[model samples]
Target: MRVLFVAAELAPFAKVGGLADVAAGLPPALARLGLDVRVAIPKYRAIGERAQDFASAGTFPVTMGGKDLTCSVSQGIIPASDVPIYFLGHDPYFDRRGIYGEQNEEYPDSLARFAFLSRAALGLGPALGWLPDVIHANDWHTALAPVYLRAGAVDLMSRSVLTIHNLAYQGWFPIDQAAAVGLNEAGRKLVASGRQLNLLRGGIQAADWITTVSPTYAEEILTRGEGLEDALQARRDSLTGILNGIDTSVWDPSTDPHLWAPYSSTDLAGKVVNKRALQEALGLAPTAAPLLGMVSRLAEQKGFDLLLVAFERMMAFGIQFVLLGEGDARYASFFRDAEQRYPGRVRALIEFSEPWAHRIEAGADIFLMPSRFEPAGLNQLYSLRYGAVPVVHATGGLKDTIRECDPVHDRGNGFLFAEYTAEAMLEAVGRAIRLWRTDPEAWRKLVARGMAEDHSWNRPARQYCAVYERVVAR
Candidate 1:
């Protein structure tokens, strides 16, 4: 089967979030199953530097506002996989410093940029003389691909599958701009939602199949009415929530080069060494205080506001806190102030470092991810692999992945709370801390069990393959 993946970001090449990781990881896994899978993404400024070899495949004209805009296609091989990655080169649209935008502002021409990308992706198969059986589009960026396909842009024998990584971003724009992106009367009807052109809604309406990251997230979107719950409910029969899997090769603690000491589930002594190393690196006193690690975008959706509300109280328990991430000026400033207010107790690296992420996962006794609504988090899965007991809110993939620690049965993997309040978060953290301070044997069992579980892409890949087959059959 021939599959073409259309996404905004592809990991190691272009990445803003987990969407990139999914685009990069899933294609290779699909290829291993004997499916001919390829990925198509815009050739952004950052990707040009890392993409090794690139030969021009030719240019095609995309119609926008009754004018022909030329888009060049370039081919390159993914470093360690057999999957081919196609770059849609349009300097005016994608040759920017940031993929979506910079400084917490989206570019006004985002509609034109991604609309061109969606049209260009559909144009690639015909240009290359290799029509795919399935075209899998990811998130709002490439959401218009399914719309384009259904609008008779291409005559290829292809079925479209749209995966909603996060339903919050719906690629909304003024209805006036619809015609510029080739949204005809029919396309506009599918996309229109109260005077706005909803790109994700268009995809959901046109795609043969719709999928979200996790089963819990799939059900939550329908119930939460997160703006598109009505549209989602309309196509409930077609929607399926497939839980995302992490790339084990990249997240494995045993072979990770960023770790202070490499260790597996069995030899947990290295975890203690890594903890001490992290304590020294962050300038925190090497006491037995339970170290809480957090690596996330400092935004309200990630529950940073709640964390800030309970920060002082949580710190009063004598637990050391370390944070590494950059997002939202308010949260960034607050966390930086926390470092100064409580020296040696709170360490906030207001930036993103891949090494630090791995170190934190390996070193910290407990990882915190109290997201208000997480689609499918990779960190909690990584935390489990590293034996870092996760203290996540019971929602979305966090609920799917982390089981609440059962002290009696000694079967659960992590600590979970149901509510989205600061008090609830503190209570969950307190539970984890109590487990760490009191019962060493049970804590070891919890960590060991988490590490033993499989979160690899193998099973999810097979599930996706089955979905592909079903979609193709339809």
Candidate 2:
């Protein structure tokens, strides 16, 4: 199968969140499965190095808003792989300081920017003389791709697959602005709602197949579909939720150079060395108390709203806490205060550093994820690989991946709390702590179980291939 995967972010080149990692990891996995896969992303100015290495694939016209805008194409290879990736070079739209915004503010012309991206991605294949059989568009950024294809504006017979990363963000815009996306009258009606135009709604209705990050998350979207619950429920039979897999090659603890010392499930002595190193590096008092680490955006969706309340309650557990991420001013202020209040026990770095993230995964005894509504989480998978037991809210992918630690039978991998309240989460955390303080053998078994499980992209990639085949067959 010839597949063209399109997304707004591609790691090492342009990355804003988990979507970048998915764009980076999935195509290569699909390539390994004996499929011809290529990737396309906007050539943004934020993508440092200017992508000068990419060979030009000539120019093409993308019609949108009743105007034919010219876009140049550049072809390059995915880092560490032979997958041919393409870039849509349009200085007016993508040449900006940020991928989606500047200083947390989204670009006002985001609708036009991404709509151009969708149409340009469709034209890229023919510009390079490599038309794909399947066009896989990701998230709200490229949601209009399927819409244009359905309108037959593009002269391709290929099927399209739209993957919803987060249902909360559907790119709702003024109905007047919807004309800029280059959809025909018939296609426009599908996405129009009251006075707004829902880009994702159109894609969901037009795409041959739909997928989300995780199986449980897939089901959750039926009711938790933000504002489009009815549309999702109508398409429930076609939507498949496949759990996302991390890039084991990059996330593997045994070989990661960012850690103080490499460690595996078999030899945990290095884990102790890493813990002390990280504690000292972060200026936290080095103690035998279990070190709990969290690396995520400190936004409301990530459960910072709940963590703010749970912070004081968790301090009583006598565990050292370390957080590394940047989001929400309220959460940042709170953590900064907590760090000062508990000088020796708490350390919060309100920033995003890749090296620190890897170090936290490798060094911390327990990893924390308390998302309010997670579609699919990547850090828990990283934690599992690094032998860091996870204490996550039992929702979406967290519910699918983590199993409660069975202290009696030694059966589960980590701790889970079903209720969204802080007390429920603390109860789960208390259980993990009790096992860590009382039973060393049980703790080791729990860590070993998580570490031993394969969370690589190979399986998920195969599952995607099945979806693509089914789409093609239909």
Candidate 3:
């Protein structure tokens, strides 16, 4: 099958989150499964030496706000992967210092920037003389691709699949820009919900198949509290939620060059060397107390606010804490205060470093993920592969991946808390601490179970291929 992947970010070239990891990782896995897959993303100025510019595949006209605009296409390859990546080289839109946001806020031209990209991908298909059997669109950025194809790009008669990474970011815009998106009159009529340009809703309505990152998340979106309940429930039957997978080759700690010691399920003693190294590097007190780690964006969605409250309660357990990430000001200030108040016990880095992230996964005895609503988490899987048990809030992929440690039979892989509250988090941490102190054999068994678990993209990629085949067959 010839599959065209339309995304805003792909790893190595440009990456901001898990979506970039998926864009870069999944295609190669699909390629291994004997499918012809090619990825297309914007040729943003943020891309570095790895990005190579190709000759333009001619110009494609885009109608934006009744104005004619031309977009040029350039092609490149993601290093190490055979998959070809097409870049929409429009200097006016994608040429910027960063990928998505300026500082903390999103750039004002996000709508137009991505809208042009959606149209450009469709326009390039014909220009390059390659018509894909399936067009797989990702997130709110490429939501309009299916919409534009439905409008008049009939040459793109191949079926389309739209995957929602996060239902919260719906790519909303002004109603005036809706027509410029190439929606038909009927399409416009269906989307005129009190003067909002719901780009994702249009894609959900247009695509042949719809999918989210996890089964729990697919069900969550149908609820009123989910924030995108209206459209999710509107297209209930078509949506499939396949849990996201980790690229085990990159995440595995046993052979990772980033760690101080490489260890696996069989030989976990080397993990302690990693822990000692982490304590020295982070300037922590360097105690034998179980080192708990957290690596994530310090945003409200990540449950950093809950961590702020739970840490005070958790301090009584006598465990040391370490955190690494960059996000909102409130959380940043809160972590800074944690550094001051707890001194030797709690160490917080407000900025993100890739090496530090790997250290946390390899060294820390336990990893914390108290996300308010997680579509799918990648770091937790990394921690599992590194022999670090996870303490995750039971939501989305966290619910799917973690099995709360079973003190009785030692059956569970990690610790889990269902309620989205600070107190609940405290309770779960307390349970994990109890397991660490009172039951060494049980704890080691849990660690081994997590390490042995397969969090690979290969299975998920095959599932995606199945979806593609089904879409094309229709």
If scored against the real structure, what TM-score would every candidate get? 0.98, 0.98, 0.95
lDDT of 1 by residue, 297-355 (tens): 88899998889899999999889999999889899899889889988888999998889
* Candidate scoring better on lDDT of 2 and 3: 2
Report how far residue 71 has shifted in candidate 1, in Å.
1.8
Q: What lDDT does the true structure give each of the candidates?
A: 0.90, 0.89, 0.83
The total number of steric clashes, by the backbone 3 Å criterion, in model 3 comes to: 0
Candidate 1, residue 207: lDDT: 93
By lDDT, highest first, what's the ranking?
A: 1, 2, 3
Compared with the true structure, model 2 gives a TM-score of: 0.98
What lDDT does candidate 2 reach at residue 465? Answer: 97
lDDT tens digits, residues 1-474, model 3? 999999999886787888998898888889989998998898888653334445445667766556678776666676667888887777788888888877887988788888888877877777778888888999889987887666654456878899999887887778876666556686675445568877787788878899999888888878942455776787898899888887777777778888898888999888989999888988888888988999998888999889877777788789989888888988888878888988888888888777888888888998999999998888888888888889999998889888877768768788899999999999888888888888898888889998998888888998998899898888
The sequence of per-residue lDDT tens digits that candidate 2 reaches over residues 1-474 is 899999999997898799999999999999998999999999898652566677887888888878989998788888888998888878898888889998889999999999999999888888778788999999889988988888887899889999999888898899987666677787788778789889899889888899999999999888878888888888888899999999999998888989999888888888888999998999989789999999999889998877888889898999999999998888889999998899989999999998999999888989989999899999999999998899999999999999988878878899998899989888988988999999999898888889989999999999999999999998
